[model samples]
Target: MRTRGSTAPHLWRPYTQMKTAMPPLEVVRTHGARLVLADGRELVDGIASWWTAVHGYNHPHIARAVAAQVETMPHVMFGGLTHAPAERLARRLADLLPGDLDHVFFTDSGSVAVEVALKMAAQLWLNRGETGRSRVLAFRGGYHGDTMGAMSVCDPEDGMHRRFGGYLPSQVFCDLPRTRADIAALDAALDRHRRELAAVIVEPLVQGAGGMRMHPPEVLATIARLARRHGLPLILDEIFTGFGRTGTMFACAQADVVPDILCLSKALTGGTMALAATIATAEVFDGFWSDDPGAALMHGPTFMANPLACAAANASLDLFAGEPRLDQARAIAACLADGLEPLRALPGIADVRTLGAIGAVQFEAPPDLTVLKARFLERGVWVRPFGDIVYLTPALTIDRGDLDHLLDAVASVLREGVPPGA
Candidate 1:
């Protein structure tokens, strides 16, 4: 019911203080690696629409699948019925993921997927008659999701969820391991809190939404090892790092570590639809396989596995199987490293880091984001900087010229020196 040239004043956006926030840009349509505005101007999408469109915007394969599915069945209740799209996607994911991550539970978004993972961890203990194991052990720089349960596991002191610390369930937190001593500290902490913990959760390699922080694969391996040693389930939140975003298909794979539970979303549908899947190992699933119906996982979302969304996800998997996405990711890493690393020498620039397709330039302090955001748009590119960093997670299929243009815009903006402010 939207009219042309309408601003849609009734619509509210996320993470914005509307009273002071500027009007958002109106996008008319999207194609491969670019967004066409209402005014017909094209801007290179620097973050792939929040890192979801891995196959790029309006991909033909995904579009065709969705269109066909809509004509047949747009949606159906998942409570009592079943569908082919969901069934196929679950089997496909079970085959794709590492180890025995063989069971798939669908949800509408990443946050709910995370919420389900936490619930599974908690209930897994309760189902086994082990009471009082309710808390989770999380990391300091990790970001899980926005739901209350997910927020509880995010970086407690320094994360965006800090204000809600008093209201959420308190979970044990430890700094990400870096050295032998740090590992010892984590080992000791695990031993100290093992009795209260139901699971150990982490964002495997890159802690997305927590300032784009990057830690080594070895650190992730050590955490997994410690969790196993403590006999606690490990939950890997791969919502931001899965589906080739971190060079390899999954960040944990870089360390050859597998988790008891894994959460996936974002590029699951190639950015065409909203969908997420929480896959668990047989061990975790078996915890609920009892004759007692009271022990069953009683949570379910209204649109747990919409047929259209599942079709899009299945089509996305087809592309991954047919394309050289990993190679493209490696190429993007090289380009990002070559372009952003030089900014480390610039004044006020604290650090520059690149992993797989993600590139970040951290400032000694956050600049005026309102001004910086407009500047990027004016330069015919789209980049949204948050916290103390301006980063890029462009589509893996972006052409070399478009990628260079995005890098040029970022470099020019930083070169001119961003004025220090919020």
Candidate 2:
């Protein structure tokens, strides 16, 4: 979707093929689930800022909390200073999660959160004098983040980092769990390579950003058990599925599985500001509690616990506790499941799947991403498609009417076949 526009100041976009990417939309304002363009047009956000703003943009509750915290103190170096918001958020998260997952390490984003998880896992093994455990085991059809360490574990066939394959560390990939046979294979692989593996990373039930793939809860439970049995750290990258994006408060909770390390971000701040946390279990933390300074987990982001982000996160969590966010998510999921059901009969579409607030339509053949997206924009919806998948993950606050509009836009585009000149 190319567009001619008045030029603005310089900026670069991530994951964009700049040579052919569409002109960036200049969003001037946002409220609820809508984006207000510079031209005064409104486009309902179909993916919730890539699934971050679960409560929607410019949410009054989150905005007020962030404002209050900014006035108090925007940020302080977390190394020496302790703040209430961050502490509250950590404790709140620990209380929300199950098991011995009681420690929280703050970071600036999801990618860094994954990095911290990997680092913690490696350091934990090293602190125990087990230095051979450096490799991470991740499943195929998984994506944690874009950072080099995170990318190293993503599905190599996803082609997100094909060019950088040689530079990234080689990691083990287990087949995505589907059948009982697949579980047998996964167990065999883990058992065979137990000594070389340091951590087992997974995206839990839903693998966002890797074509928004999803699997059964049993798969995650199996991975968690296998990791524990192998004495390997299990890291659930819930950056996309945490905060009620996957029908549960955390996707792993649906399986009643507890991981040793959990990476959380995206919706942690209700999409207000960038903040992430790599939470750990007592065992992982205790591994670094020795008197040896070098055995410690030494990673920390400068804005580890930015007060504004923490305040927004607190308000978001408060909303989840006091409001009906989970109910809203379930409603959104039902809406998507019913709304996109018709698309399965479409000629180009091969399958349609819905989970929580996320709905994906996979094409039998790859659709022209740029042209399809242009048509969606023309229909006043902000739906982004990549490769052979077109997905909608609207804010939990989006009404049935707005969500229908978003779904209908995708259906209309599929019906019209991208138009004559789109």
Candidate 3:
């Protein structure tokens, strides 16, 4: 049997340099907002399982739903047949979302959902007999996903996928429109590239995994307006900022803007399991509706609309409907502001900002992540810092004590000071 502190040698970790990186810790169990390690020590989960477990780990509602679903039906192909869980989830999502976003395409992960959205955007034009509209206009600091179609639209020069620039197809990139000049430049670029542009994709408010960069709601509104003016479909990558992460149920709501396509995952199943959805507006869906089967969107994942995942997502939506999740997110934002904002004056800390349930403390320069991670673990918190930023996206249901503990641990580590060198 594998022992504590020793991950299986054969297993490769994501975004890790195996040779020098620290060994992965063995988490024996999780409950609420805490992780129980193999050696019996508990650590407050500062990132909420990569911002998925909004209602905390192993919530009874989601667990019970999954258990019941497993007994009745575990797996089924969504290619030809439809299941109650998937159908119900689709309806729930359509009703919950703003505008006419009434269509849902299920996928197994966030990345694949993004790929599906991109496909829909591209194919929408093709089905309309419009050629030369193959490229997408994506924001500079945006991150759609790791899949090929999604990667093509991500930030090309500075994004994590830049290493694959030689392999991936090129897409137009622009900064999020912030000022009048920026908006005008974006408008000019859209007009210049109107012939080749199929869609305009962006991360509504917060650009997660792209340095947690943020833009105001007005910026999003401006982008949406420009896309409408150009008669181009807009795609919103809300996989990270959806479900109360940015204070509203959906980040697009803050701007009163609805996209033609919206990708969602992460916290869709309350972080209990993998499930994702790519929803489209009525206008986008109409492009694929025809007598010719060739007009159909031809991509489908084998595990599309897995019954178990759908059940979990349905239960997660129930929690959102029944519980005060939006209120919880607001509370978290206030708490984060109170706890982390003071650290801005600390040496080495460049900026501190909070939105809804998210908080970030960016350093002037990249600190020694390995040393900082060790210090956080020693202080009994699971805080992962990457590339000059130490951010928090804890579970919305995390109790004040644990939340305070997480903030305190981060403060203690900063007080000790980050070691020089990356």
Candidate 4:
């Protein structure tokens, strides 16, 4: 393996190109939706640090809970042994999740949670003696994560896994139901491959990383009905849409549809620590409930259900209940949407989409992100532009003043162009 210094600049970058020259801003500290840069600049966080940090950075409740758990027991292998925190968190999640998704399988991140869900779906088919139903189906412009199985279900046009062409598993993709034609195309595809389909995975209501495209709840309900009609399981990847991001506790709640299996992450631990869970119904769990060990769901990470993460999750649920975070998120989303209405009338704007606390403004052409990003930064607002689409996904705890500042920055950029050095 090459040394760290010898690696290419782009190899370890989180997202986008690192080799392409861009100005760097260092954040040294953060608290309650504000970030303090190492250069003594403070700015409001618009994207919530990649759409996590729901309760904002360094939340006292989360910090205290995590610290207490660490002091008691930092970690333990979850394969066989059990812990109180994990059990409590699982029970809380079961109570909060929409339907009978009672079982929880924890993993390190959203990517691994997706991998677990896909494996469970395939194994469920196998246990039901439907070996022919091995192929997985996902929608175009959907992004799950970066793991191999997750990559297989994601849209190849996303350009994340182009280099690993042969490494990915064979899967089917259907167009997102943006129009009648799109829905018809999906039904046709299902008719063509229903016998071979194992599951249909979707990022309900809104597609996050795929430029924040929003679709109606009716489209999701249609897909759920089709899945049931075809005897195929449905998996909802609500890692980004969960926890009040979609104006409801879960986007599926709004549609009155429930998936056989659901993937949750992102704000699961109140953005305090990395934690993800794949909750499934008893029927799905029954597939692995056999005396024969080989029939078991033989997949789990070493750090599954770590106590510290579990404690943080439990505390997060408490905060949600005490503060009514979902209601707060709804109000904030409406405010942001109203504030952004003027952008729709702007010259270069292509579309403005909003769902709950997430709003996006896509331009006809890719703006000079370098300049636009700098302008926002200079204005004490930290908003990220995904290519041509500038989006806001602030924490639920964001103050009204900070939210107004964020909107003002966008307004300034639209009117005067990017500021100097931006």
TM-score of 3: 0.98
Can you tell me which runs of candidate 4 are displaced by over 4 Å? 1-11, 418-422
Tens-place lDDT digits, model 1, residues 28-112: 8999999999998999999999999999998899999999999999999999899999999999999998999999999999999
Better of 3 and 4 by TM-score: 3
Instruction: Give the runs in model 2 whose Cα sits over 4 Å from its true position.
Output: 1-6, 418-422
Model 4 pairs in collision: 371-422
lDDT of 2 by residue, 1-422 (tens): 23234254255567765555556888999988999999998999999998999998988988889888889999899998999999999999999998989999999999999999999988787888876888888988888888899989988876587678899998889887678898888888898888888899999888888888889898788888877887788999999999999899999989999889999999999888899999999988998998888987887788899888899999999999988999999999888898888888988678998999889998888877778888888999998888788898899989878988997888888988742222
TM-score of each: 0.98, 0.96, 0.98, 0.94
Better of 2 and 4 by lDDT: 2
Tell me the lDDT of candidate 4.
0.86
lDDT of 3 by residue, 1-422 (tens): 33324458777788887677678989999999999999999999999999999999999999999999999999998888999999999999999899999999999888999888878988988898988888889989788888898898888988889999989977888889999889989999999999999899999889889888888999999999999999999999899999989999999999999899999999898998888999999999999999999999998899889999999999999999999999999999999999999999999988997889999999999899989999999999999888889999999999999999999999989988998764
Model 4 weakest lDDT span, ten residues long: 1-10
Residue pairs of candidate 2 with colliding backbone atoms:
none
* Alpha-carbon runs more than 4 Å astray in model 1: 1-6
**In model 4, how large is the Cα lDDT of residue 128?**
74
Q: What is the lDDT of residue 126 in candidate 3?
A: 88
How does residue 30 of candidate 4 score in lDDT? 92
In candidate 3, which residue pairs get closer than 3 Å at backbone N, Cα or C atoms, i.e. clash? none
* Model 2: residue 379 alpha-carbon error in angstroms: 0.9
* Positional deviation of residue 357's Cα in model 2 after best superposition, in angstroms: 0.8
